[model samples]
Target: MFFYLITVLLGLYLGCVGMQLVYLVFIFSKTGQYHRERGSLPAGSAPAEPKPDFSAGVSVVVCARNELDNLRELIPLLLQQDYPDFEVIVVDDRSGDECYDFLLLEALRHERLRLVRVNETPQHITPKKFALTLGIKAARKAAILLTDADCRPVSNQWIREMARTMEGDKEIVLGFSPYQVKNGWLNFFIRYETFYTAVQYLS
Candidate 1:
């Protein structure tokens, strides 16, 4: 009789677990699904060019430490953004490499490009957080777009799209950056992990 009771309890437990899994798969859909066109206008007829939102000038902030190579490739992509009235701010956070020199040269060539060279990060604060805070504080515009030095904007309209999310009482916006896929286990695992995490969060 005890063995039969144990078997019954085991079956009940399994049923509960199965039901939870089914709920996750069918009911909860938070992070699992994403709206690709959430902030973008419908891509049909050519919409009238949006009037320059003077109140929403953007400051594009990038924090770098010893990333001269990545900066070279990505900075130009940022500087050439098709949006108007935005500035690109690159904060060189105590980099030992040629990052400062490169930024200095770039700043000279591009009027909208500015550089902030930090010689040291305070003991109480971590280096990256300090650099990011400094960049945000230094931003001239009310709107700020923060990204890493190594990141490349997928489109010239990247800032435009991100900025659009700030409309109508929205202060903070979150974005996802997918890693470049390569012919390796690491890339495959990363892709799988991303999908799994999204599913779990959405569920």
Candidate 2:
């Protein structure tokens, strides 16, 4: 009986591993197919014209509970994006910290900055979700981009790069975000897991 149980468990484990390999291969094939299609246009067709610059207005929405320190770094990066038409909306979800006061000052300094204050959250919904909903609704533009307070863009061209993918009928675009590298086993594990999750979804 013990031998039979071990054999069954091993078989199940192998089956799960095989399924995971298959899924990864399938996702990778999709990426290859996309590139191939782009590379080989119809033989007789004229060269495709370059896509125009993304001029559509974009609104970046962020939800923060008590992330004032991180916000101080992230908001400046967001405001400095090189996009022509965009707005930054920060949602303060009843933070006990100095977030409300800081956002008030930022709004005054930058005409493109908007603030949404959330004093009460419903028992049925998460605070982040509730705050994001309010911020999105308050957005002046149709294209809404969501990010966290802790996230920092690597460059000012972040918005432009993201918007470039939204040309044509594309409704959604996902970008890669690896965790900041730190000198600890926990940080290493977290970064590895984040990369794995990004591969699983972004492919």
Winning model by lDDT = 2
Candidate 1 residue spans exceeding 4 A from truth: 1-28, 32-54, 194-203
Worst 10 residues of 2 by lDDT: 28-37
Candidate number achieving the greatest TM-score relative to the actual structure:
2
In candidate 2, what are the lDDT values of residues 80-173, reduced to their tens digit? 9998999999999999999999999999999999999999999999888899899999999868898999999989989888877777787888
Query: How well is each residue in 1-203 modelled by candidate 1, as lDDT tens digits?
Result: 99999999999999999998887767656455655443655668555555534568999999999999999999889988888779999999999999999999999999999999899889999999999999998999889999997678998988888886677677877776767778999899998887666556545
Q: Would you give me the overall lDDT of model 1?
A: 0.85
Each candidate's clash count: 2, 0
**Model 2: CA > 4 A from native:** 28-36, 39-52
What is the number of residue pairs that collide in model 1? Answer: 2
